[model samples]
Target: MTPSKRLLSLDAFRGLTVAAMILVNNPGSWARIYPPLKHAEWHGCTPTDLVFPFFLFIVGVAIVYALETKKIDISNHNQLLIKAAKRGAILFGLGLFLALFPKFNFETVRIMGVLQRIGIVYFICAAIFIKTTPRTQFICMTGILILYWILMTLVPVPGFGAPNLEKETNLAAWVDRLVLTENHTWKSAKTWDPEGVLSTLPAVATGLFGMLIGSILKGKEKPAAEKTTWLFSFGIIAWILGMFWGLFFPINKSLWTSSYVLYCGGLASMMLALFYWIIDVQGHNRWCRIFVAYGVNAITVFFLSAIISKVMGMIKVNANGEEVSSRTWLYDTFFTSWLPSDIASLAWALAFVLFFLLLLWPMYKKNLIIKV
Candidate 1:
């Protein structure tokens, strides 16, 4: 596909990922979540764990489509970098805003999060794409993954001797504590943030993985069938490699391990390829309308949803002589009252996804994409 022509498959893939994110994030009760929706406790992979990485992978693919033209001209490089930096800053600021909302607690607020990581990975990957060849990008990605593995496994933690991948004492956790301090780390686990400093290295590799796939899809000379074949081939190879790597490194989302990067990116690649084949090549996209709507204005919906969810929690209602969050009251009244706890939670989450789809459908019909 050319730079001017939009990729419906990519948009659909992104939309699906974002929809999953909203579903997993906004259950009626966190306590009553299904296993698939919940992130792996420490070392393993789950459907929920795939969501963030898939989005990051999409970010990488998006960078190629967005900047391929500018990349061809060296003169446009500086201007492109400036624009990327500005966009990254906006993303990071938005994440920070979410963290500070309602409470506005600077001292205790978590610094690193999903959007912050996306912003950081996007800028770095964009810079790499701008300056380097695809071959070089692949090499860089490989080197970073290997280096992270070494650092996490070989280099001993300062206070907590002998490098390990435990919850709070690992090298990544140590870096989180030292740099961000316990105060700025994840609220639930003040000792470490899942989106902590060290783990971001592999996260960038995940983006680079998507960039590679994006290059394959963007190739002018390759036939659509050939491109799909390559996507499937590369995806399978990466997935198998990730599984092998996991034997040693273990696939851990909290740490964003190199293994997890490959595993998630590989699945994301195969998924995008399937979408590309069905939607872009065969012109069978009738069922993808809802995803397209979500995909087009993804960041806008995500930011708005998060803000609204936070507001819902902040607003209180009197419930039988007890003050409770509006979200809790609504859940109790509309969902849990009638259905089983787990099913009710899932129902609420599904409703939340559909609600956003309803909001986005009109905007999509009018072609009103709110770029963030």
Candidate 2:
């Protein structure tokens, strides 16, 4: 693929994920979202569950493309190790900074997050890939996915004994208690974290899968058309297999089950092939420009929005001398108030996405990509 071709497809994929993220993350009323937009309760998949994993997958693809056979010479392996260590630390440090923002508390803080998972996986997987073959990398990915599944499903929890999907008894919660000091798990699950250790194992697989794509893209002599066809064909096969496995393992984001990994990986690949076809192959550039803009500086926009939304929620209106959060009032007045129902609020959230995309368009055009 040409540089433009690469940029277009990644931009579109990243843009779509980032936009959906904003929508799901900022709904006016969580109660009102369409079923597809909401996450599965315990052990299932939803359209919403695909976004974070999709981002992780993309990160893996990028790492392979950027780090493979580069002049970053592995002649002095120690130097390469140092570089990997620094990158991992920096990524984790950034995640900590975001977790500490607005308030820094040792207690009741989130220790594991999306960025943290990415950081750890990048370091571990990159270290292995840097010293190993593509075949070994594939084997490692498969082993880790299956290993995590066995550990979570078969290994008995201390005291609690065997693992169950129940919030209180799951391996996730058990490990969080052992590893995360109390109150440091995601606030949504005071005793558990979706970004916990066992889950991260499969997430590494997610990234490894992307590395496979990146390697294929970096192939020396295959025709682009043949590559595209195989990608699409492979996606179909994986989707079918994943669904069948889901019947036994059950696709769940919180657990980051192997089946979930297969399902999301397939979905991500299909979306990529679609975007590559429509944007790169078909030369349809109009709508892609908007997505590319948001996708380019995705992390910045996400963190910025998180902080801004919190700040806005803190703004209070002294209505009749009674304090109330103005954020809700503003969103309702601007988006939810006039709308007939929940769909209107959803539309308003989407408009909010495009508005930010327009804001970010110039930065993307100028080749300004932000990374943590």
Candidate 3:
């Protein structure tokens, strides 16, 4: 693939992932969510868990395409790194803004979040892509996963005694408490965070997994069929390995375990391979326009969607003599008044996805992609 040419498959995959993120995030009622939409309480993976890793994987693939030209000119390396740092900072700042919105409580705001993790992973992975060869990147990715597995399973926690993968007393949780403190950690847990310090190491591995695949996709020597075959094979092998490793470490998204990295990365690789074949290779992309819109201006929609959702919750509306959130009032009036609770919740989320699609379609047609 040429550096200048856009990858429709990638944009479609990204759009699909972002759309899934919006859908899972914006249910009319969290309590009435479908089982598949809910994240696993502690261990195991769900469809919802796949969304974040897939986005990071897409980020890694994008870094390859985005920085291809800059990577060649040695003189441009510093400038490239600076630009990446600024973008990462902006993403992290946006995440912080989301956490601090409405209330703006610095004292109690959660420091790390979905976007914060994305920012950190993207910068580190981009640096790795720039400074290291593909072989070295693979080694770094593998080493991080192995080191995390060892640390989380073998090393003992300071005050917690034994090494553990339990929610509160795990090594990652202990590190989060020590560095971010309970105040800055995830509010729901208070003692630990899913996007904590140590777990991010494996998360970086997930990005590297995508970077490796991106390297393959960008290679000129290989035919499209060969690339698809290799990706599918690698994905299946990695998937099996992840499941086997899970027997010991247990695949957990909350900690982003090494096994989980392999599991999700494997699935992401296969999914991208499929998209590349059907959309990019076969030239059957007409069906992907909706997702393409979401893909091109992904960050813009995500940040805006989150802000709008927060505002929806903040705004109060009188509903039958009771003051409820606008979101609740809308859900009650439009969805739950007729449909079953779980189905109504899902319908609301689907409507949210289409709502953004409607907003993005015109922008996509006009080629007005927001860079951020």
The order of the candidates by lDDT, greatest first, is 1, 3, 2
Two-way lDDT contest, 2 vs 3, winner: 3
The per-model lDDT (C-alpha) reads 0.91, 0.77, 0.91
Cα lDDT tens digits, model 2, 34-151, are 5567888888787899998898877776666656765247685567667777878887877777788767876766888877887888788777767877798889888987898788
- Evaluation by TM-score, superior candidate among 2 and 3: 3
Clashing pairs in 2: 157-161
* Model 3 lDDT tens row, 1-372: 112467999999999999999999898887899778999988899999999999998998988988876789999899989988988888899999999998999998999999999999989998999999899999999999899999998999999799999989999999999999999999889999999888989999999999999989988899999999988988898889999999999999999999999999999999999999999999999999889999998988999899999999999989889999999899999999999999999999999889887789999999987886
Candidate 1 per-residue lDDT, tens place, 275-361, comes to 999999999999999999999989998998899899999899999999999999988999999999899999999988898877899
**lDDT of model number 1:** 0.91
Query: What stretches of model 2 exceed 4 Å from their correct place?
Result: 1-6, 76-80, 319-321
Error of 2 at 335 (Å): 2.1
Q: After superposition, how far is residue 201 of candidate 3 from its true place, in Å?
A: 1.0
Error of 1 at 283 (Å): 0.7
